[model samples]
Each structure stands twice: as C-alpha cells, then as structure tokens.
Target: YNIHPSEKLIQAFRKKPYQGCCPIQAEFLFIGLDANYAYDIEEQKIFPKVIEYHKDAISFWKKYNVHHPFLLDGYKGDGRKYHKEFSKIRLTCEDSSRISFIELLHLPTTGRNNLRNTDLDKNHLKYIHQAIVSQYTKAVFISDAVFRLMKKTSTFSWMQDAREIEGYSLKVFHETSPLIYKHLHFSTYGKFQAQKEKEMKAIHMIISKI
Candidate 1:
C-alpha cells in the first residue's frame, strides 16, 4: 500500500474478489470494505448521494424549460430510501425489517448548504472531507483542492473518526464491540474483549426478552 501507484491505483482498490451469498455493491458499484469495517464513508461503499441523484427517477434536465428550470439533486429523503431490508452491510441490525448497508445515525452529507464559492477562506480539502464524513452529514461542498488532492494522491482515502456511543447495548453501531469488529475497520480483540463479549451476550438476552 506504500508504493505510489500508477493510474491503476483506484482500479486496484476497487478490485477485490467478492463471492458472497448476498448482493454486494463492491463488485460493480465499487462498494465494499477493503478492511473488515469501514473507517470512513467512502470505504463503507454506500452510493455517493450526488452520483445516484443524477441517475434516479427525477430528471430536471427534461423538466427544465428556458425560463422555468429546476432539477432534483442527490439523496433527498428521511434516509429511508437507502434503508433497505437487505443491503450488503448491516447498518441497522437484524430486525428482519430495517436492514441497510450501514446504519446511518445522521443525515447524508449532500443535503446541506455547505461552504459557498465566495467562502473560499474555509474551502479546504481536509476540512471539507471532515465535514461530509459524519453520519448526519448535511452537505459536502468539495473544494477544488480536495479534488486535486484525490487526483494527485490517486486515492480517496480520507481521515475518519469512529462513531462514539454512550452505552454498549448494541445501542449504536460503531460503539458495539462485536458489531464494530464485524462491520468496521477497528478491532475489539484483546484483554478487554471478555467484557465486550459479556456485553454482547447481555444485549442478545435483551433482544430475546424484547
């Protein structure tokens, strides 16, 4: 991973041997984990909001007239659309109902009005990337620097902060030890793992009770 790759760097990351019983976006959509669980949104492999928005049922282009012009843009909803009963990953756990690729705690980044072009002082690559990585990401006004960096690095690898949780009842995705280990890039195995197992068992008991 250290080598400065040729033009094929992105293609390299995208190419992974996938043979699962379930449908994975990684095969064609370039959605799947290089690691166990995703550390960042890009690694999670969820559909890019704007990318999917342009292709969805809405077409502002055909609807737009000269004077009256409008277009519905990317991921606009209560987040229930992506909340599939069965996505490749598990954001919402085994409800047999609220299945999804990754359990989203916040809104997608595309919905908000981020830094404007006039607001160039704060339009930095790292800043923008950080702003959009949140589960409740309002919007990502990607700056030219961000784009250039990706192109230059030939990598979309960005910094990601694991979601924090207040408790350990599978109450949150990133906080649960087993779930995190299963679905996130972090690890839970070590001396403290015993406590995590106990907590997981306790949660299972709670689920059975409920």
Candidate 2:
C-alpha cells in the first residue's frame, strides 16, 4: 500500500485535519499521537458520507456504527485491543454520544518512530485548537508523547497541578471543564496488562468527575 496521502486528501486535511468520527460538543476526547495509515483517494471519496453519518456523538455510537477506517474493528466484534480497552472505560458511562477521538498529527505514517517534529506545524496546532473549541470538549485523554509536545505550546499551557495516577498523570486548570489526562499510549496497554485494571479505574474516575 502506498504510504503517501493523496493530493485531494492532503488538501481536505488543510481544512479538516481530523479523521474518524468527531461529534459536535463531545464530552470525552481521546487524542492519539498520529495516524497509522496514509489515506488515498479512495479514502477521500468517502469523507462526505462519513461526515454525514457522524452528525452527533449519539449517532456516531448508535449501535456502534463508527465509520473510521482505522477503527473498523470497533464495528466488528471486540475491536482492536486498544479500542477494547477504551471501550471498557466508555462503557462505564451512560452517554455514548459524548465521546470522540482525534490525533495530534493528522498526517498518516506507519508508526510514531517514523514521524518527525516538522510534520506537526502551525496548521496541526490550529486543528487541535479548532477541535477543542468546536467540540466544547470536557475532558481530553492524551498520550504521553503528545502531552509532552502540547505542553510546550500555548494550547496546553493552562494545564497545572499535575496529579499522578497509576504511573500516568492528570492535569487540570479548573475544577470542572477540560480535564487533561496523560497516559501511556493505548498501543502499549497490552504490554502492561498487569496494571491495566488500575489504569482503567483511574481513568474511569476521571471520567466520572467530568
């Protein structure tokens, strides 16, 4: 498979840097490091349909009809292992429409090790800001690496009073909105199975507080 995004998709990204179902006014936002696959013209072809289907958080998760290419496993039985772990926490709550997922870097690549800082320019930061603003996100679940990067930027500069939880950390600027939890990347959850329950509980606690 060609690992380069199509020109059309690249232009589309200049307007909307996020892939997958991102609902309007999402309560829970999960931010990943980067995309795992480069999107081609075929992927671009379905963008409109996907956007139409993802009208709101409730519609996006209704019967679990999520339509993201990377998250197709979610529509199947158990989904990917990391998604399964995310589901565990999501299931703890009643409103499914309040959850959403996005990435720090919209550019697609095979893995994080292959990515460079140059890939995350001003447009990417603007996209993140736009996502948070448009969605009115209540809480943000971020990977450790992405957290480190965002910390240097003004977007996450408001984050203060870091509290550690099961080897992960949670940062908050206020008593209520936009609780930012910094955790080990979901891809590494399987390797730390022994600590999974603890981490899940801690994450659930954060969700409940929000």
Candidate 3:
C-alpha cells in the first residue's frame, strides 16, 4: 500500500522546482511570452510562480501509489484508470530517474485541468501529454531571476464553473482552442496539442504585432 522509496530518492526529490513562464496551465503567461519574443522576459509578471516540481507533493503522489487522477483535491478514485505508468519512474529511487520523472510529467494536464466522464479511457492520452509538455521542461530553461519572481500558488476554486468555461471556449475556438477540457474527453492527444500550439502561435502573432 506504500511506495517505500529509499532515502536517496527523498533527498533527490528535495531539489527545488524550476521557475519561469509556466508553459503548462499558464493561460495568462502566454500573453507575456508573446510580448518579449522570449519566455524569459515575460514570465515574471504572473504571481505565485509555478514550481518545477512540488517536492512535498511527491510524498502525496506516492501515497496514491496507483494513479487514479484525483491527485490533490479530494483523493477520489472515480474507477477510471489514469495510466500512471509514468509515475513508476519515481519509484526507482535513483536520483536521475526520480528527477527525470518530474520533467517527464510537468503536471498531468488530463485529469485536473481537463476532465470528461469517468467512462472515457485516458490510458493512451496520458502518455502523449507527458511527452509533448516535457520537451520544454523548466530545468533546462528557467533562470534564477525567473525562479526568484515565482512562488507556488494554491490550487483554489480551480474548477469553479467547469461547464461554462469549457463551453464558451469550445464555442468560440471550436476544436482549435487550448482548452484541454474540450479535447481531453473527445480528441486525440496529438490533435489537442497541435491545436494548442496553433492557438499559442496565433495569440503570439497577434500580441507581438501590437
């Protein structure tokens, strides 16, 4: 019932989280990223900066052992599988892999950010989101100045009006919007990300011109 990782893993995970323009879940930061032509300059504005890895949260992650999606909010296992196959990496206890897994799963975008009926299968999509998001992980790009400006924000009222927000975006952007809730329940991971990039590029292009 527990993932008793070696003390080495605990120490390894204690390392700090990267700070910068949180590309993931950073809805407003993208606006800044477009203005600077570089992520470095724009990421400073957002409050409660995103952490590279929630080290303390790691213990909670291990508490679940088998991933069931509801990681922090309520620990409710909805019966649908989360394919935490990726989490297995953290169990290795080797510093390299434990740290690497952090980069691999920046933050699971599927469950918390976007969710559909528990009836839907996400085993395949989880694998895809992990790969695309990890490519630009913070350990590689964030600077001390950036980290200095960032602080971890609390996850409060994050899902306040799920349907209204989800529906509005879906209505306006249709399938192209970056609203993961639109696709998490219906589209392929590649399609969702591709549209996300498109939306990002479109916004950046518009903002940079002004």
Candidate 4:
C-alpha cells in the first residue's frame, strides 16, 4: 500500500511548534515524546524545507521498496536505544509494514528532563488525531509520558476500558477498531531490564489480538 499524507496533514506538520518529520499513515501508530536532535531558532527557519526533505525521502523509499528509515535496524545516535526498542515491537507484529510513528512534541531535545516545558499547541494534538483517523489504525503504542499527557488533555477520554499488562495498560476503544497500549518510555528500557521480557510478552499478546 502506498499511503501518503494528505495536503492538510502536511500543512499541520509544517506548522508544528518544533522541527520534525511527518509520520506515514499506517495501521499501527507509535507515539513518542519528542526527538533528540535539537535545531537552533535560525536552523528551524527552514522547517518547511525539512518537512519537504522528509516527504521526498518517504517518496524515494516507497518508490524503491526500501524500508522506512524509522524501521531500519543498526541505527546509531542519540535515539539508538529507543530505536532498538521500537525494532523489538516491530518484530513482534505479524506485519511490520503496518507500523508507523509520530511524536507528541515535535521539539528535539537531548533528553526530556532537559526540556523546560512540554506544553503543546492544538496543532500538535490535531496532527496525531489526524494521523490516527486518516488510516485504518488498528493499534497505538504510546510511551508512558505521552499517554499521561493525552490523559491530561482528555484526548482518549472516550476510551473507558483499560486492561493492565504487567504494569503497562492496554486500552481497547471498541471491539477492535484501535487498541491503545501504554508502556514505559523506550529509552529507559536499560534501567528496567528485569521487566523487559515481561513487557515484550505483553506487547506480543497485544499484537496477537491485532
């Protein structure tokens, strides 16, 4: 399937508070906090250009049948740990092609702790909602932080049932339209190594139902 972002969605991404790439539409959406690469105000002036660059990259990969850079293994850099964890979840899925990702905050920082604030504008939340509704998103794996943020904003207020999975929570919006799973931030997996396997099992259980 050659899924593409709509022009309106692309505009939403362009006007995001921070610099980041637009997510591809897919069945599974992974929501995170923010990126690790920070750009100065001057550099951020070209955010529109950066968005176009990412759009072009997505088009090139789709045309060549190459894996999305976000799904590639052996990545090295600030977000390597998070990338590794995402790879594990991707592997757990029966069809990796159905997965894609987006960040609640487009701002890039070396660490969440370093960020002065996490306040987001309406556009950021709209971008995520659009990403979900635009595709046949069957499931969403959200980082604990992002999940909490959504809860505070009542973004998933319609979701009334949540099933606990080894400390994590899996919420089903309906019979199976979209299953929202909340787990610890992927970057902190190293600190909770003891529960890694259990979390993976929980993730597998969720995917099995998908």
Q: What TM-score goes with each of the models?
A: 0.21, 0.64, 0.21, 0.60
State the weakest 10-residue window (summed lDDT) of model 4. Answer: 1-10
lDDT of 1 by residue, 77-134 (tens): 3222222211212211222221112101111222322322332212232332332343
Candidate topping lDDT: 2
What local lDDT does model 1 show for residue 20? 17
**In TM-score terms, which candidate is top?**
2
lDDT minimum window of 10 residues, candidate 2: 70-79
Poorest 10 consecutive residues of model 3 by lDDT? 29-38
TM-score, candidate number 4: 0.60
Taking the tens digit of each residue's C-alpha lDDT, what string does model 2 give over 13-117? 555555434534567677776655423324444444434433443454554454333344322221245665665654522455556666666654442344445
lDDT of each: 0.25, 0.54, 0.25, 0.51
Report the C-alpha displacement of residue 206, candidate 2, in angstroms: 3.6
How many collisions between residues are there in candidate 3? 3
lDDT of 3 by residue, 1-210 (tens): 111123322232234211122233222111100000112211323111112123433343344343222223323222122223223223322222222221222212212222222322243224323322454322211112222222121111121222334323221211222232211211224646565444334433332332
Candidate 4 stretches with Cα past 4 Å from truth are 1-24, 38-53, 56-76, 90-97, 113-118, 154-162, 165-176, 201-210
Q: Which stretches of candidate 2 lie over 4 Å from their true place?
A: 1-16, 19-24, 38-60, 63-79, 92-94, 112-114, 130-135, 154-161, 165-176, 208-210
Give model 3's TM-score versus the native structure.
Answer: 0.21
> Model 2, residue 79: displacement in angstroms?
9.7
> Which has the better lDDT: candidate 1, or candidate 2?
2
